[model samples]
Target: MVAPLRVGIAGLGTVGAAVVRLIEEQARTLSARSGRGIRVVAVTARSKAKKRTLDLRGIDWVKSPLALANNPRIDCFVELMGGSGEPALSAIEAALKNGKSVVTANKALIAKHGLRLARAAEKHGGALNFEAAVGAAIPVIKTLREGLAGTGVNRVYGILNGTCNYILTRMEQEGLSFAECLKDAQRLGYAEANPSFDVDGHDTAQKLAILASLAFGTKVAQSAVYVEGISSIAPEDLRAADELGYRVKLLGVAVRTPKGIEQRVHPTMVPKSSSIAQVMGVTNAVTIDGEGIPAITLVGPGAGGAATASAVVADIADVARGIRAKPFGRPVDRLRDTKKAPMERHEGGYYIRLMARDLPGTVAKIATRLAKEKISLESVVQRHPEGVDATDAAKKASPVPVILITYATSEDAIHRALEAVQRDKVISGRPQVIRIEKN
Candidate 1:
């Protein structure tokens, strides 16, 4: 049998430790599948004395991650550290420079420095695999990089953040407020103490950037992606969405348009009948709209130690089997610089909910403002307080909830109309606006 494929691991956290345990437990199976024994020869973590499930008795313990990454005895450097900065970047670079293959579950590092890393990996004849960076255990990266390689993918989008998805799902199912759902998520360990990165849509945006590069052959451009979180989504918004036959989901969408490649992460109102809308809780789903083929949607656990380790090990197995491909599905130098489509010019149906003064001309004023922007309203609903007529409600100065579902219109038109409504003092507070996506 061929010599065992030596592996070095950095950051023995949940996923890293899981990978180590999994490799040992499945050693015989992996060896048979890869035509060689997969071995964990070196490992590094913040603390060597930390209690772990794995038997580190015979494994070589390194002081720094960089040392494990640069160890000559290791054939593959597996990085499970969760950051885009520091020793992670330097160590990955060192591994590639030393002609060692790399497998990582770090989405931030891939999103921020993928191009340079890909170039290095290709130049050094080393494999750089990150199937675990996107949708964990979903094979999304493999689907895009292999299964749909020849298919021209025009759009790629999904529920990439599990924390936001869990919050939204709880809010919709339990009719709980955002804060309540967030607290529950934190308690359940689905969210971090500082959850801004996941809840604010940066997490989805980073994943979207990586997917966009593979789907469109464009360079990763995290900054170019427009982002909006679900922090502002209220129970009323959920009710309104249900009333309109839709479900509110925080989605990361990227599509190739005539203007350019458009990438955005935002709370979207998808048709209730759509598959993506059916995904709830911490589960994730990705849909790819390719040319000349029906849309493909892959749904599974988005994150966890075991799921992420599954992807990481898959990448390692491919490396062991001598299955190497371009990091981004094409030569690094051939990837095109992404041209960002202006979000202001994006045309889509919108769900706008406002708290309007209960006056005779209030609805008329909103209609006129929308018309001025050339926006067409598909439906207008004025909700009054229970046991009160419009006249009595107006006499009491009670604010009425007004919902307007607009026909396809540019984002600029919607913003301009909302600004006009705010300036006119027709709406009491900021309006809740959600983009409506078909499928």
Candidate 2:
């Protein structure tokens, strides 16, 4: 029988400890399947004396991540440290320089420096596996890097962030405001104590950037991906969406249009009947539209220690089995230069809500502006000023609310029409506009 493949693990945090436990428990089974045993020979963290749940008596404990990456006793480096630069970057670079295979769960690191690391790994003849970086337990990175390698993927997108999905799902179901749902999420540990990154759509955008590179074979560009959060989604919008047979989800959408690639993370209205719309709570779903094969959808837990560690162990199993593939599915030099399409060129349906002065000809004026911009409205619901149905309310008050769902139109047309409505004396405050996704 072949000997065990020595592994070095850095950052014995929640995910790190989970990896260790999983490897130990599944060693025999995995070895039989892979024809080689997998063992964690070396481990490293910030503090050597920190109390850990894993039994580390026989393993080597290093003081720094760099030491673990460069340790000669280990054949593979598993970086579970959660960061984009510094030690994580240095350790990964050191591993590649030393011709050691690497498996990581760092999404930010992949999104920011994936191309560079891919080049380094390819240049040094080392495997760079990061299935855990994009989707916690979905094997999405592997799907794009291997399964869909033969197909032409026009778009790859989904609910990449669980915290945002949790908050949005709660808001839609419980009719809670965005702030209320966010507070509940933080208390439930679905969101961080400082939840700006997840709630602001930046976290999803980062993951989308990484997926976009794999799907399109291009360099990851987190900054180029347009982003918008659910912080501004009001209860009224959620109610309006429900009334329209839709659900509001913070979706990371990417498309390969005739013009170029369009990537965005925003609060979008998806038809409630769609499979993705029903993916509620902290769960995540990714949809990939290929030209030949039917659209593929993966739904599962998108976060947590065990789910993420499952992905890390899968990478380890692949290494043990001698399965190797490019970091981004192709040679670094073959990856396309990302050509980001402008947001204005993005064509899609829209949901618009306007608070207008309750007076004669207000709706007519709004319709006229929309007509001038060639934006056609599909449906409109007018709520009485008393916040009740028009038929039930005896007397209508001032500043009535008007919600309209429009047909497919360019973003520029919608922006122009909304701008014209805001300038009119009939409309009150800025109009609320949310894009409607047809996924």
lDDT of 1 by residue, 257-299 (tens): 7788999999999999999999999999999999999889999
Could you tell me how far off, in angstroms, the CA of residue 202 lies in candidate 1 after the best superposition?
A: 0.5
Give RMSD to native, each candidate.
1.0, 1.7
Which stretches of model 1 miss by more than 4 angstroms? none
> What are the models' TM-scores?
0.98, 0.97
Clashes of 2: 0
Q: Model 1: how far is 252 from its true place, Å?
A: 0.2
Please report how far candidate 2 places residue 374 from its true position, in Å. Answer: 0.6
Number of the top-ranking candidate, with TM-score as the measure: 1
lDDT (Cα, tens digit) per residue for candidate 2, span 1-439 = 7888999999899999999999999988989988999999999988887787789989999878898888999989999988889899999999999999999999999998999998999998889999898779998999988988899999888988999988887887788888888888889899899999999999999999989888988788998799888888898899889888999999998888888789999999999888788898899999999997777999999999999999999998888888779998889899878866778888989999988877777899999999998988899888875546654442353677899888999998988888888888777778889999885
